[model samples]
Target chain A: MKTWTIKLIVGGCFILALVVTVTSFFCNDDFWKVNAAQALTLILTICIAFWATQLKNDVRKKKEHAEQILKKIQAIVNNDGFYYVSAESDAIETQKRMTMTFRSLNNSIDLLKKYGQELGFKVNAEYIEKEFKDYRDFVSEHITDVDYLSRSESTLRKHSENIDNKCDIIIWGLY
Target chain B: MIVINISKDFTDTPGARYKSEGEYSGELFRETILIPKYVEAIASKSQLKVELDGGYGYATSFLEESFGGLAREYDIQEVLRTLVFESNDEPGLINEITEYIKMARRERK
Candidate 1:
């Protein structure tokens, strides 16, 4: 089973052991020794549970961070044309990687946008970028890309003409 | 799979050279071009071949790393055909690559 499950099991066992020790002390006349053992076991159990919970939280935070990084990378690779850096940036290596990935994504978007314009494809970069940014902002609060993208797309479509040029400029600026 | 051979000479153009020699040489051209292109091609149900001219120097290192990163992310093996000589600047290189692509397409058929 999972490590967390194992920890929980072990922690439960310690609590059980403490309960048994206390009960045995109350039943038999060995008041001092059994009570001491029960007290120690109870403290150890609490400590173990606290540590296990901390470890689980740490693991969860790490997984969330990794997923966030992957999402940013995937967004760049998927030709979304925007890179959103967390307000709290990390180390030099992370910054370098993020910058490089953003630059690359930016270039690709520029190339595609240029190609679309040349081909007379009705893709407004500014509109798309704004919608994407707004969606990203929404997701920052809501944490859902699909919902954000859908809502932004609908909103952009509703106000397309006025924001067409604006959206194109925003996408170009992202690079 | 559509494999596009990217030679060091392809990145020797003034724009590419400037970008490479700039403060972000670690960023590399392949990371900028080949990796995204490969990902795009794959997502669109196409194969990409990145033909390398040689397996040495800064250009090679960048290409290798970029290819490895893409491969790892995609979880699919990629082909990196190393040419004995660097020839991206040569006019015939494009033609040679076009032929290779054509042959691969035919094999797929």
Candidate 2:
């Protein structure tokens, strides 16, 4: 449940408990019965408030964990760090740069899937994996073309942005 | 298993397809290192395990030319059966090389 929703519930319970306690004092003719009713409502309110606090703490911890994982993914998908694969670029260096980053991204996606599944987050792991692989394959096939290289770089930037958006959805979905 | 560590046996920085392209070219590797070891494995009836780690990284052209050229020289199935890959650093390269090997045979036919 969302923090706001939990806050609302706690607020409502507090108000209800206050009203019950105040009314019981007014109904002095049935003193014992009113006291019993007031005690029950107060206990119930306290229980609900404690439960909400626990839930809110758990959500906060999970969000922090998700952010850490997303940061690692972002670093792997650092599009700006990619080597421009062109005629001038050394073939050995280009291959090294592409393969290392691509493999690291694959590993990150695997980690994301494992944690996302464990945490009940709906991660589009397959889509992310496909996007990374497609970009690598396109680079491999069109290494010498400046135009194609430019396009791949743009696509890579977009892919990185897409990953950010996806992570945002997962974080927001927690609410 | 007859092992061939490319990084150990040949250059760690393997380059493009043909020897004319540059040093440590896939063609050079196939001729100098891969083919001779493959021949020995065949004679001994053992698997040639090509360890594709400890290297900088491989170009698609390098992988395709080396393994695909091997498939071209030998029966495709025989090459596939005789050669096993150990590429823990980049496991995906194994599949990529396998596809290139298969495609090279198809192109030959």
Candidate 3:
């Protein structure tokens, strides 16, 4: 049973006990009986109040626990790869889905590396440098064309500036 | 009708393994192609027929489903007889297949 249900049952029993004691005292004309009844009722009242306080504390603790779990999941998502955060009491379907997604991501990353290798082109600094050189040559050739240069001076200037920036980046990397 | 005969020796590329891991593990590289409307229509029309070379059929089914195009799996002997044999060693065949796929996709669209 849930924690709340257990608390309710225990509280009900304490109240019942208090009621019976008080009723028995009224029925009898004994002084001890009345005093005992009063003492029992006071004890039961205190027990009920204590139970209420515990229930409140339990609710607060649960809320804090859930928030902490959420923060952990968020941290994982941001730092690590995408994955499902399974709760202790998560349904079977939820666990299955999380597993599937994780597997899929793992496979994709693996395949990407394989494809890069298969294509003789290395996706690294050497490839980037070759591409930059080709781009620079293309821009220089276009800029040197008298008709093209005359017609679009601003555009040519922009292209040359971009090539210069790329050269600068390459030089910075080398150093 | 352009028929592509992929050899059994062709294994799933690392990329292919990742994308369709649980679902498919075939040699057909659908990721490299850019097919539009017609490809989708062809896939939708193609019925999945399983045979001894059922792996090809499964891969075709996956592509058909993904691209929304038609795909028909044939026996190795039947494929060899009907389709023009393109040497796997030829780099041009890749381009040809890409072009044919694009053309078929366009026509279907």
Candidate 4:
């Protein structure tokens, strides 16, 4: 469980203990009061001194992992290689360039995904790298067929625009 | 049984492994074409025969993701029962794919 969740649960338990203690005192139940107080003290001490401390340490580790992931993600954001799409006159060549471009982005995004998986975070932007395969396939099929090349190029261009949008979303979401 | 040619119906970019578009990469091939055809074959009670010919050499990762992931998604028995790969002159391509499927099944266990 999250450290904060554990803390909240422990806090609730302590409040319940206090309410029980007050009720027992008003009822003049000295034996029950003493037992409840001792039990609460022991339980609180164990939870606070051991479990809470361990949970805090776990939280600290996760924080460090997040910081590390953010650092790597930021470093990846500065990589401007995927920012420019080739403007080559050849539709086939241009599409080939885009495939390679997404491959590069995929590698970057995949690395971050690996780290995110390890740290138990969601990295849902991998489609920026992987989902372009369908368009690439369409482009590749029409590479030699100039008659269909226009349609392929147009579709690829549209998909490229969508990919660029996802790229921005991925960059912003690294945190 | 329905046999689909990888190099013909798909792209003939041979010797490709990982992330080439079309039938060249295993993952893309599986996601785009393989699974769709497989599902169709299963629904129709037909065995899907996949021709691995005309494409580039296979990569272990691609094979793993395609067949292995398939095993992970569906049952290994179902995949084995529903699918067949043409030797495509590649002596051990089917074996390699089967190994991956087996590995994935073991992982599930």
Give the fraction of native contacts in model 4.
0.00
Give one digit per residue, the lDDT tens place, for model 2 in B1-109: 8999999999777766787666777889999999999999999999999999898776667788799999999999999999999888777678878898899878785
**Which candidate, 1 or 2, has the higher TM-score?**
2
Q: Please provide, for model 1 over A1-175, each residue's C-alpha lDDT reduced to its tens digit, 9 standing for 90 to 100.
A: 6989999998999999899989988897756655778899989999999999999887566444433433343454344322333334342332334324423433343444454453333355434445433432333222212233334544433333333444334334332
Query: What are the per-residue Cα lDDT tens digits for candidate 4 across A24-49?
Result: 77877464545778899988998889
Clashes of each: 14, 0, 11, 5
- Which order, best to worst by lDDT? 2, 4, 1, 3
Each prediction's DockQ against the real complex: 0.05, 0.21, 0.03, 0.04
Give the per-residue lDDT digits (tens) of candidate 3, residues B5-92.
Answer: 3333222211122233332222223433312222442456432211112121112223233222222222223222232323323222
| Model 4 chain A poorest ten-residue lDDT run | A77-86
Q: Candidates' lDDT values, in order?
A: 0.42, 0.75, 0.35, 0.59
Give the clash total for candidate 4.
5
- The order of the candidates by TM-score, greatest first, is 2, 4, 1, 3
lDDT, candidate 2, A52-153, per-residue tens: 999989867876776677677766666566634454566556656765676676656666666677577644655665666666655545443445565566
- For every candidate in turn, the CA RMSD to the true structure comes to 18.3, 7.2, 22.1, 13.4
Model 2 chain A lowest lDDT segment of ten: A139-148
TM-score of chain B of each: 0.41, 0.97, 0.24, 0.79
